[model samples]
Target: MYILGIETSCDETSIAIVKDGEEIIENLIFSQIETHKIFGGVVPEVASRLHMEVLNKIFKLAMEKSNLSLKDIDLISVTQGPGLVGALWIGITFAKTLAYALKKPLVGVNHLVGHIFANFLRKDPPNFPFISLVVSGGHTEWILVEDYDRYRLLGKTLDDAAGEAFDKVARLLGLGYPGGPAIEKAAEKGRLIFDFPKIKCERELDISFSGLKTSMLYLIKNLQKEGREIPINDLAFSFQYRVIEELLERSFIALNKFQTSTLVLAGGVVANKYLQKRFSEVSKRENIKLFMPPPILCTDNAAMIASAGYYLYNKGKVDGLDLSADPSLEIF
Candidate 1:
């Protein structure tokens, strides 16, 4: 079955066609990073407008690249929630129109769950009953995946998400927007000198980054007050270290608590080289199999959404035209 996936949950306007939820016939992503770079973060209004403008073009490109027509599409899948409402609405509306015109089935997928399912696109995907760490700009969550469409929320960020913290700290350091890559690049040339406080959550599986971000804020202010040169590289290294440490610490705790041997890393933050390297080393040491999607699928894309929609559709999940975008939709 060929599934047409539309994703406009945020700044990215993506359209993809996936075959049987595993093979990607065509995946097209139009990123708004350059447009939002000057703003230091995504502006929802601008993101929505960009999605509306580029979605059609992206869809056409996907079709051309895949050499497939609308009639070849068997299902329509879209990211329904847990994103900017206006942005989500664009994809939802476009998907509804296609479903109506093509007379195909439509399914709304949770953005977070779609991230997890991105692993299925891999040649050797992780099996069921695994633990997933989903870290993105808008969310930080640890989920226990019992099976496709069955997820148990183990823990999540009580404050700012890891990606959000990265962005704020990057801005604080006068780095460019989309802080992850900027900080990652800067940290490579520096050492981890600053000893940022480690977050201690009430729950063993839970994660917190608010205090860590505050600590960085004060450290920078103190340096400015003393007229000391702010070591941007060292600060970025230390900050990235502390954040990834907290994430791995909680991940280990969850692995031990659940006794799950398979671990899946998903979301935009998974693109961090440090996080990937550390997780790879630790998972090996602990004898836990780790699965992560390629960098292209790491960020927002329609392929994951289509893969998720395929499974959901096979399980008899379908939506009507009344289906609306839920910005706060939860994965159950």
Candidate 2:
């Protein structure tokens, strides 16, 4: 069966066609990073307006690029939550209308679960009974995935997500928006000289980045008071080192506690070179397998939504006209 998936949970407006749940026929994403950069970050209202303007064109492009027509699609899958309400409504309403017009099955997917299924796009997909880490712009979470659609939440960030921390630190250093890539580039030219204190909570797998972010800001402000101009590159490296170290430390602990044989990382933060390297090194030391999806899949994509939708579709789980965007949708 073929599924056409739509994703507009945030700043990206995406569309994709998946065949039989395994093959991605075409995945098209139009990013608003450049547009939002001037505003320092994504403005919810602007994002919603942009989605309203481009979603229809994107849908057409997705189908054309895949060399298929809407009539060839068997089902429609769309993300319906945990994002800006306006942005979510655009995609949700569009998908619902398309599904109704085509008389196809409509599956509303959770944005977080879409990130987890990103692993399926990898060459060596992580098996069941593995530890899943989803670190992104708005969220940081650890989940135990025993099967498709079956999950147990282990821990999550109580404050700002790792990606949010990255962006805020980058902004402080005069770096551009979409801060992860900019920070990674700067870190390459510098060394981690300053050691930032890591946050340790009573919970084993839980994480907190807000404290780290605050600490860095305070340190930088103090340095300025001393009439010292900080090296942006060194600061970037120091920040990344602490962030990645925390992620590695918590992941290792969870792997041992869960006795899982593999580790799977998803969400946009997975694209950070520092986290990727740290995760690989830590996983190797523990003799646990690691699976990371390609960079494209790491960010929001309809292909992952379609992949997740396949599991639900097969189980005869479909939504009716009552389906609407749930801004607080929980991941199952």
Give the per-residue lDDT digits (tens) of candidate 1, residues 1-332: 99999999999999999999999888899999999987768899999999999899889888988888889999999999989999999999999999999999999999999999899985677888999999999889999999887999999999888899899899889887789999999999889898887788888777787788788889999999999999999999999998998899889888999999999999999999999999999999999999989889999999999999998999889999999999999888
> What's the distance in Å from true for residue 78, model 2?
0.5
TM-score of candidate 1 on Cα atoms, chains taken together:
0.98
Candidate whose TM-score is highest: 1
Candidate 2: where are CA atoms >4 Å away? Answer: 122-124
Q: Quick one: best lDDT, which candidate? A: 1
TM-score for each model: 0.98, 0.97
C-alpha RMSD of candidate 1:
0.9
In model 1, pairs of residues that clash are: none
